[model samples]
Target: MCSTVVTPTDRVQPDVALPFGGWSAIVRDMSEEQSTSEPTRAFREARDFLLAHREDYETAYRDFDWPRFDRFNWACDWFDALAVEQPGVAALTIVEEDGEVNSLTYAEMAERSRQVAGWLTGAGLQPGDRVLIVLGNTIPLWEVMLACIRAGAVMIPATTLLTDADLADRITRGGVRAVVTSSSEAPRYEGIADHCIRVGIGGPVDGWLDYEDSRGYDGPVPEVDTAAHDSLLLYFTSGTTSQPKLVEHTQVSYPVGHLSTMYWIGLQPGDVHLNVSSPGWAKHSWSNVFAPWNAGATVFLCNYTRFDAEKMLQVLATYGVTTFCAPPTVWRMLIQADLSAVEIQIRECISAGEPLNPEVIEQVRNAWDVTIRDGYGQTETTAQIGNPPGQPVKLGSMGRPLPGYSIALVDPTTDEVGDDGEICIELAPPPVPLMRGYRDAKELTEESMRGGFYHTGDVASRDEEGYITYVGRSDDVFKASDYRISPFELESVLIEHPAVAEAAVVPSPDPVRLAVPKAYVVLAAGREPSRELAGEILQFCRDHLAPYKRIRRIEFAELPKTISGKIRRVELRADEAAKVDGGERTEHSYDEADFKQA
Candidate 1:
């Protein structure tokens, strides 16, 4: 299922990865503007190094350095540079469900964003103002992003799916000063941020300025002279807890940090890159906005209210998509459809949001002749580990530490380095990609970056050859019958069953054994829930899994997920805990002992 995307014959040996700084460097004795360009140079040098070594991981990882910047504005320096270099090249293209297409070339995008910046500035937007954006993959979203950067305003990306209450919390937490949304979504902001300036797209609304007005503002908006440490975006992480955490990204952090993301994705200039991600989440910025564009590739989008794998494949082929990124959920849905039916010219495929099942990767490689590489990242930083292009990828491993990242697996009990432990990023010099910290939560921030490392709070196992296979979340990994269990491992096996489409494994309380593994499964299309089906699955699990690891209980239900589509195992585990304490029988649950072993 795994194969190298490039050969040694493709490029010569000058391919070194981004190794700009292990010690943070700030250019001295230079003008403020000149100093800004110095880090930009350092950033570009590092970027070009990764591009040169896109297929040569061994040399890249060993030699890569982190670029340091004191002042960096990506929208002005980097994006505008690309626009000037490749004016007529496609930068953004979106296909609507009705077959209508909208596009902007690099030059056109730059011009439009400049116009938007001018309009927003004229309408009372000031430097450091937080603008909450709630929109789909439309033209204005891109325009506002660049516009915010030009004005030195911090952008807070919110999904169209947010309710009025969600908007209130974000406005209060993020300190809203303005709001940009579609005419349809403008109503959601009423009384949320009442004094906040409202710019609505599509059509005019009462007490709201139309985005169409920006078309008339013809003058260019000058760039804001911003420091690298200035906050550019505030992301509210999708959390399983009651309230989400606000993650702050600096002007350089995402814009410059995504050089690592660009390297991991193996993006090349002029390639049409499509990443399936919601706008509000960090992954959207990781792949959709920053990564592909960081590589000077086209950011492609297909707007849809519902997912249709066949229709999506059609769009992919029609647009000649060269690079594709989708979540594990989308990949699972694609495998259910007839993938061979659609002929795509996709050269690179990546899965994020969760670890992709090996079975899903095998299915895709069989049909497309290209492997679906998996990557590991978090909202706190850019891509840390990934199977880069042309590298020999291990089936379950998410490759090694990216060019700028220094990964360590530290044992929880002893705080010693080990092969299997919590994934932590070396922070002695601090990677540029790391977030400034948790916004307004200094205690939590210090706690996370404590002990000379930025703890990822995720666990994994590193093999002898340097491949890291994902275990489960630190919280989700539990002990069953005194043996540690990884939910990801069990869920990976469950999905291999013919009847199962998606699965989440959690520790179920058991009086005799202390705890046992239980699975909550969603059946494949045309498969109905019944004791017959559950028994069949139990038998399958019993046959394939170890005795202690076998599924002791099964429940047929839709998995609980965050709005960003990540399955929430903590919720399921909580349910199991309540059942054990209350002595309540779980509804629609089937016990493996009901169908005794042969």
Candidate 2:
């Protein structure tokens, strides 16, 4: 058993007497040292600049300078330097579904990555070569990731859930020169490319290189010289509207951008951080890879094929998770379970990916005595706006901008700064954390970066306190009879109904009103998808919402979502529009027709 003690509020400090055997120990000591060391002039200067105009958007927007570095390798400069003395520190703790657990110390992970790097280099993988990595939440995933980073090679991380078509598109579009995947997935890449080398994990395959043999290679790993601006990752965005666009990140972009994420999570050295996210997506990297590790906290992972709120709660209590982050969907599911029976040691709870409904936040706070803080960002950047520690968290607002980010709300039509409009980053030259650009789409990239801002393509409203409240996406919010209807707003209210497990609201075309609100709802586990339940939800909407915003039509169906688990509102809207075009019209909706009498 671990001897480190933790308070309800304060983080666990480094255990000096504990055996320094893993990645966790190395990170903890490093974080502890950095926290006490006098802040560098550069760090102080950058921090002061951010504090000076924490809420003064106009001034910060004009005055702030993004920190620049001509030579910086995060692994070598920060991680490896810190790992030298703390060889036994635990770096990663992974709990499998069947209760089996695996851990790696910082020193062990570093050496393993070095060996993998040596093996990869010996196999003719060169710096800047793109390698497609598709694997689950496993040790080899992290080993190969660090190896790729050390090798100065770009990686395209793909989720194993992707289909053959998805893999084909990524291989072609990403210009993948190699692939490192499980032996189970070797068949997917059979005919793709002859030049692409396949490094299979978990036993040898007939045509693929064995990952276990990589451990035996006696070759010394060469340090590849890498610049901050070199491409490091190419992420294909989960397509909610159109085809997935390849988002390019530089060596410094994510490595540095995650500073914002670290601050947002309020992670500290020796803290055990658990983030609920799948492999391959940006959020996974945000919490699982960069944020916790950046802060020298233990990356605690609980892997399950299906989400089990009870099982997760047990892990949090058993593993002593100090900080926890999850999307709203998971939080909503947890709310349905009896949280009172679960013991959680979490110091802070955070929500991301989508705007967390205020009801869910309040419910968790009531039960767990911890606020579920909301945060906002995209695949293109790290946590931009979030409710940080020691800050007042408004009920529904995603809090103020972080240290390195400068957020602006510009009116879409006027292109002038405003209290309510499209969110943008007003950088003279874009910040280091911002993606290099959408890969190979010069026209799209140019258009997005125009108007002196990196347009987020999402809408929001900023109040006097600088807390930004998310509105629907630019395309998701539609005008019904000249009144702007935010689907997210209505959906938030809709999900509060007992029958609704999930909900997506969109505009349904109407001749008289131009458009009307329609809801596609997924029923809760025990609830049947019937007209009676639909009528109850529709009535619930009418009781809570304004007449104009009340859901006029409801369809019992599963909400369409991107593979990343974000609801595809664009697809929902397109389907509604098609229904209208097909002349499938509702004569009387819930409000117009008296359902109470029936």
Candidate 3:
């Protein structure tokens, strides 16, 4: 086992963790020195096993064990340990719009983080204090995250895109004691609670302290000890249907738990990884922070105010990004560009945030000769299922369960395990990556963690080979003509049409069939919303989908989405329900019957 296992960046131990106080006291008594901690050796052994068998999924799955340790800190343990051995290695790199590139070596990052941790300690931040970090993909972001982890403080990562209202909600619910954001965003924090400490990046502010000052703090700070189960981060989920849930993760849960995510992305030591996600969300941490770092890979970021696929490709080519992860929305836009015009250095490409549409995957393979593997995870857990490297990717399948995850499909009606049903995880051996629970919502958390399983609230179908196909969200799946319907199945087929840019399928009410598939589509830039175009799209779906799955109603309008860029099918479902007289044609809507009569 390597020295990165149980080591932390800090050299001193605190009396207790913030808010929750001292779970660390016991951990402290058990082991004062982590260099020889038994649990740390176990964790290193587990991590090395996955990396050793990155492509051999069957052997890795059969052997991987979730490392259990009472005292663990990723910053000092894994990252700084690597710095000691490979100090000059690149840890993080960012490319600006005007071609200004900034990078930090592993040693530089570790020491800089220690400086920030020392500064934060001077600011009276103690263990367990919730620090809400709101910054762009700046170097300070990484510094602050490591500082918080080293201090045994709970870090709440927020995107700069979050509104002032979102910050208020998080502060109230998350009990934030400190906030770090840019000076331009400082005005948003006006009249916030006086208890919250504000640290501004870039320039300075009247009442805010400049983040640049952290570099001046050359003082030493002791390593803060936190238990494996102590709260480390509180993530506010991007709500697609209901209000956002405050998902909590302990120290090991995310830092150590992302071993699966590391395996899923097929990250290797010294690989340059570029993950397309803004700060604040779970996926950003998944690929950008934990997964890549777990494998000793360098994280690359291309900062852009506005997305340009061609420009991004140029950056990817320049940076020699070995591994890449992007959301399906970004993938769809990339397919729109002339992929052949640009060169890409990315060897492994993965898609998440939403299921990968097969058409998008195929187009990229045709253009780049690399398959875009799909992965499935959420704010609640690390990468649980993914099409890992070297595996034959079955189109539309999100691969088999990654090591450390025990997946089961349970029929909601029967509550019995089967080939298809609600996707759940076995709790007998609860996966290490799974979140503790939704903060302050015991009822909701219990409901989600019932039956000795963690219910994912999504549905999927499993094959004999253990490959699972995402059906749809549990609520989004409906019955049409006495047959079960998966919106994803219909939507995937609909996007294959050349005229469709993006598509969302919902159950449209019908008198005869009780309900029928209706597609709410956004047309490609050059296409018109005429009945003629609608006929071609419906015909395309009819030829590919089952008879019952055929889209009977078409609405060529902009699809509604949440702030986080998820297609809000619930809103579309409600709009269809609002229609009177059973069903009637609306603006830009074309029924299949009208097109057939043509």
Candidate 2 C-alpha lDDT tens digits along 469-554: 99978988998988999888998898788777778888888898899898887777788766566677787888999987877888
lDDT of each: 0.84, 0.78, 0.84
lDDT score of residue 307 within candidate 2 = 95
Tens-place lDDT per residue, model 3, 1-598, is 4423232221111221121122232234334355444555666688889988999999999988898888888876766666655555677888888887777766677777777898898988999999999888988899899989998899999888787788899888889999998888888888784678889887989887788888677566648877889999999988766778999999999999999999999988778889998888888889989988888778889999899888887877766777888888788888888888877777899998778899999999999999999989888999889899999999999999999999999999899999999989899978899999999999999999999899999999999999999998989999999998998888899999888879999998888898999999988767888878888888888899878778898998888875456788998998898773456568788888886542
lDDT of 3: 0.84
User: Model 2 off-target regions past 4 Å?
Assistant: 1-66, 583-598
User: For each candidate, what TM-score against the reference?
Assistant: 0.92, 0.89, 0.92
* Model 1 lDDT tens row, 1-598: 1111221121111211111220012112224565335655676678778888999998888898877767677877777766655655677888899987777776677767777888999999998999999988897898899889988999999888887888899999999999998898776777776889998899999999999888778554657989989999999987676588899999988988888899889998777899999888889888889998787888889999899999999988887888999998899998898899988889999999889988899999999999998899999999999999998878888889998889999998889998989999999789988999999999889999989999998999999988999998899999987899998888888999989999999998888888889999998888999988899898888788888788888999999887667898989999889987998875678887777662
Model 3 has a clash total of: 12
> Cα lDDT of model 2 overall?
0.78
Judge candidate 1 at residue 8 and give its lDDT: 15
- Which regions of candidate 1 deviate over 4 angstroms? 1-40, 580-587
Q: What is the TM-score of candidate 3?
A: 0.92
In model 2, how large is the Cα lDDT of residue 564?
58
Model 1 residue 376 lDDT score: 93
Please list all clashing residue pairs in model 1, or write none if there are none: 5-390, 18-65, 19-64, 19-65, 20-65, 21-66, 71-228
